[model samples]
Target: MLIRKAHSGDAQRVFDIRNQAINHQCVGHYPEADLAVWTRGELSDYFIEVVANTGHVAVIDNQVTASGLLDLETGQVDAVFVDPACMGRGIGRRMMDYLEQQALQAGLSHLILDSTLNAADFYRRCGFVGERIAQYQSPRGLTLACVPMIKHLAR
Candidate 1:
């Protein structure tokens, strides 16, 4: 497996992972994402517009299987997802390593993320301590649900 900064060419694979996260778990969406939910151009636009420091993707067997973003704002880790087929193999941990490296290099002292109900344990195992009763500021308003987790980078 290879991990790298996402490029325009990675639009499709990232889109699939994102949709899977949305549909299968609350790590990404409240409702399900339908197939053909977004066009290639739309996905690219989203990558550029919302993924924070662009995006990071993990490719295995020549296919993208995991993805996440380092949000410059608040140093929040966003959009972390690994294909369900590839779960239980530590792919998510590797992806977190990539995101954490970026955060540390950027001089960020903390990495924050909204942990899905199903992913709280995973995040905890990744060394993220739960910031219970936390709220996330979203476009809709402040999000008050979900387990908020944080990993402090050693200074």
Candidate 2:
């Protein structure tokens, strides 16, 4: 697998992967209505800007299999999604590792994120710590439950 910075053209694929991951992996963890609301919509201009800026994609066999976003200035991991078909292959972990490395290189001392219910354990295993429930206000105007997690980077 090769991890590289995402370009604007990668926005659609990244959006697709986000939807697929949420639809398949988040079943039972979220209400169907909430899931529908969360995943609704096409790739927005905001997402395109993000892809061109803070995004990174994991490519396997010439296909984008996972994507993540790291805001260096804020030490915030805004997004991390692996295609449902590619789940359990350690792609997400690799993506996280790459994002963390980028954050460390940017002189960040910690990283923060709001993880979906289905992914809280994964984030925990990745060394993030948090269990208190939080509400993530989606850009699409949906409110969803999440776990606010943080990881202090080892210098």
Query: Pick by lDDT: which candidate is best?
Result: 2
lDDT of each: 0.73, 0.93
**What would the TM-score be for candidate 1 when compared with the true structure?**
0.76
Residue pairs clashing in model 1 are: none
List TM-scores for all candidates, in order: 0.76, 0.98
Model 1 residue 126 CA deviation in Å:
0.9
> Whole-model lDDT for model 2 versus the true structure?
0.93
